[model samples]
Each structure stands twice: as C-alpha cells, then as structure tokens.
Target: MLVFIDESGDPGFKVSKGSSPAFVLALVAFSDRAVSLEVQAAIDAVSKQLRVFPEFKFSKSRPEIRDAFFDAVLPFDFCIRAIAVQKERIQSGYLRSNKEAFYSFFVKSMLKFDNGLLKDARIVIDGSGERVFKQELSSYLRRHTEKGAIRSVRFSDSRNDRLVQLADMCTGAIARSYRDNRDDADRWRQMIKAKIEDVWDFR
Candidate 1:
C-alpha cells in the first residue's frame, strides 16, 4: 500500500496578486483493490452527485467527466483531508517564508496517519522538481524514523505523474471546498485532526 499526499496553492507569505485562496493542505491514502472498494464506492457516489466526469482529470485531454458509477472511478478514492490557510494570516506574516518551514508544516499535517502506517509502506510524494530538496528530505526521514522501518519518500514531477494525479484530486477537493464555503474550513481542519486520531491506533 502507498499513501499519496499533496497541497495546492502556496502557503507562502507572498500570495500571487490575484489569488483569492492562499493555500490548501491535502492528504490521500491509497491501497490495492481488495481494500479500496468501499472507499472507491463512496467516492464514486460523490463524484456522481457533483457530476464530475472523466474530463475532470488533467492527464487526459478532452476527457469526459462521467460519474464514477456512470463509467468507473479511479481505482483509488481518498479519505481526502485538507486545510486552507487564511489570507489574513499570510499577510500578517504568521506563517514562515522559508521553504523548509512550509514543508515541515506539511509533514506535521500528514503525520496524522498512524505513526507506523508508513513503517514498511512506501510513501510516494509529488516531486517539487528540486533534486537537492528531495534528497535532503529523504535523508532526513531515514535519520528520524524507526530503526529499519523508515517509509520511503519520493517526488514526481508533472511529467511522470500517477500518484501525483491522485494527490491532485485530493487537493482539488479541498480547494473547491474552501472556495465554496469559508465557514466549513474549520470543520475541515478538525476532520483532519480526527482522522489522524482514527488511524493512530490502526496498527
């Protein structure tokens, strides 16, 4: 099993001039068919409700966005967790500007998974296109994780993307949610926190 997590928009203090939403944090969990069916079913139902078809995906050009049940949903559906960083916070300099600070925040967000759900499981993260950063992060995980059981960390740029595509969906869901209802943002954060606790005893 592999877990794919991602975020959309920058949490950086420098928000693009026209950007309304500043940042989003998202996490997605992936598994093989046998265990992924129920989650897939729920996702399909949701997609149908939203009428998102195949075209929703960027990989395929002119892809038709049919209901997952109408045709089929991605083999993997995500628990889909996310948080939107408030614009006021960014303008006020409450968040850090350095890249490491941004990444560390994501690490803490995703660590909600059971401490060791990642123990032996490989972790595939969407690459940031920076070899130096990737290498440094991989080494850091190895040094900090449990002896002989550290989960692998990887990055995938837009060119070679599958896991990243899925992560995109999770991030997109969060983006849409935040865009639609700012009030629910707090609830979304709480859901992520609760999910972290739910999986804490998973092992």
Candidate 2:
C-alpha cells in the first residue's frame, strides 16, 4: 500500500493570537499501485491546465482551480482518513506548549488506531517545513506506531511530490469543515466526500 500524508494548520495553541483553532492531519492511501499512477497522471494534467507553477495547493488556488482539481482527481480510487483536533479541547500542558509533540502524537494516533487497516505501507510526508521536524517525525512514526505497520517513511518536497500535494489538498478540505467563520466551509470536502473513509474529531 502507498500512503501520502500531509497536514493543514499549525500545531499551535495560540488560537487567540491568530493561530488556527483546529488542526488536521490527513492521509490518502492507495491500495493499488496502478491506481496511484493514474491519480498522479490526473494531478499532472490538472497542473498543466491550471499552470500551477510550483504545485497545486488548496489554500493557494482560487475557487475555480480547486473546482478543477477536485473535478480532475475525484474519479480515482483512494481512501481518505483524517483527524481534526480542536486545540481548545486539549488540556495537557505539554501538548499545548509543544507543537512537535502535539503533531507527532496525533499522527501516531491516526495510524495506530486503525483497526487492522494499515499494514507494511510506505508513507510519504510533506517536507517543505523544517528538515529536522521531518526527520524527527520519520523516526517518531517508526518507533511509536505498531510494529511492522509501516514499512517505510520518507520526506518529499511538496513542489516535486504531487501525491503529497494531493494529501495537502485533501487535508485542506477537511480543515475547512472545522472553521466556524467560513460560510462555504463544507463545500470543498463535500465535493470528494465519497472518497472519505473517515474524518475523526479527536477529543
């Protein structure tokens, strides 16, 4: 199995100071390698059509682009699994203060809590952030997750990794549903709702 993981929102507790109230960590998994390639070709076509120079990102793209992106990639077979955490619901001081700890814990939770779903899967995560953070997350997933559940984990630049970008777009759609201020919050996620296996609200 191939799993592409990406997150939307910062793992910060400063919600009152402009930080997002909720954070979403999502993974898009493909059980068949051929389907994965098909989706990659779809992404490539969308990129060419939209002239998305770097990569296709949900936040960076306009509504039309998002529409085109979802329209292009929705036909493929994939499973979306995600965890959305409301920071205010968290009481732990350590998790509240430590962003890395918070991110790693929930990521581990998302994969470990899977009831025999994931097995020996290769994971690819967005590596646009600090290299140290990616390196640590790679190790953390290996150590904290169930033994042999993850066959391998690697970091890839989102610019070059279209699959990771797909994960980002999926995560952005899930994160949008958690925001209270947006009127069209559920619109994007609903577009690809059929592909979603679960959107867990972590309490």
Candidate 3:
C-alpha cells in the first residue's frame, strides 16, 4: 500500500488575528501501486484536456480545475481519511502555542483511525518544512502508527509527486467545507464523498 499525506491550513491558533479557524490534515491511501499510477495518469490527462499545466496544486488551482481534477480521479481506487481541528475549541494552551506539537498531535490522531488498512504501507508527506522538522515528523509518525504497519516514512516535494498533490486536493476539499467565508465550500467535497473513508472533527 502507498499513502500520501498533506495538510490544508496553518497550524497557528491565532483565530482572532485572521488565522484560519480550522486546520485539516488528510491521508490518501492506495491499496495497489498500479492504482496510484492510474490516478496520476488520469490527472495528467485531465490537465491536458483543460490545456493547463500537468502539475496541479490544490491551493493554486482554480475552482473549475479543482472540480475537474477531483471528478477525474474519484473513479479510481483509493481511500481518504482526514482530521479537522477547530482552533477555537481547543482548550490546551500548550497545543495552541506550540505549532510543531499541535501538528504532530493532529497527524497522529488522523493516522490512528486507519484501522488495519495502512499495514505495511509506505507513507510520503509534503516536504515543504525544514529538513529537521520533516525528519522529526517522520519519526513521530513511525513511532505512533500500528507496530510494523508502516513500512517506511519519507518526504517528497508535492510539485514532484502526484500522490502528494492528490492528498493536498483532498485536504483542501475537507478544509473548504469548514470555511464559512466561501460560497462554494462544499462543491468540490461533494464530488468525492464516497471515497472519503472518514473525517474526524476535533472540537
């Protein structure tokens, strides 16, 4: 199995200072490596059909492109699990102030709900942070997931990995549902509702 991880919002809890009210981390798991390739190919094809760049980042893509991307890949075999943390409802001062701790906690929280599906899975995460932080995050996930279930934990640039991009898109869709400011918050989400295995909302 192959699993790609990504997050949608910043880990800051300054909601009163224009920070996002909720943060979302998502996991996109493919049961077969072939399916992963198939999904990547589909996304590339869609980008060509729409006459856009082959590399699609959820945050940078327009809503129409995002919708088309999701619609193109939903027919493939994959499962998504996500955790949405509402910053305002969190009561722990330590978690609120420590960005790394908060991020580590939420990532583990989301992975713990995977049941046995993630067994022997190779996990890749967006490698946008500092090298040390990425190493720490990998170790954190390795220590917390089911014993021996995670075969390896590695970091890759989202621009170079289609699976990581897919995870980003999934995270964006889940996070958008919680954004009250967006008029089309749920539009992209409804496209892949069936593929979402679970979405844990941390109040």
- Which candidate comes out best when scored by lDDT? 2
Cα error, residue 68 of model 1, in Å, equals 4.9
Looking at model 2, residue 115 earns an lDDT score of: 67
Pick the TM-score winner: 2
Superior candidate under TM-score, 1 versus 3: 3
Q: What are the models' TM-scores? A: 0.59, 0.95, 0.94
Global lDDT of model 1: 0.50
Spell out the clash pairs found in candidate 3: 120-149
Q: After best superposition, candidate 3 residue 108: deviation in angstroms?
A: 1.0
Q: What C-alpha lDDT values do all the predictions have?
A: 0.50, 0.89, 0.86
* TM value for model 2: 0.95
Better of 1 and 2 by lDDT: 2
Deviation of model 2 at 121, angstroms: 0.5
Candidate 2 lDDT over residue span 1-203, tens digit each: 99999999999887788898889999999999899999889999888887887898888888899899999989999999999998889999999998888888999999988767788999988875687888888898889888888999888889998899899999999899887788989999999899998888988
The predicted structure with the larger TM-score, 2 or 3, is: 2
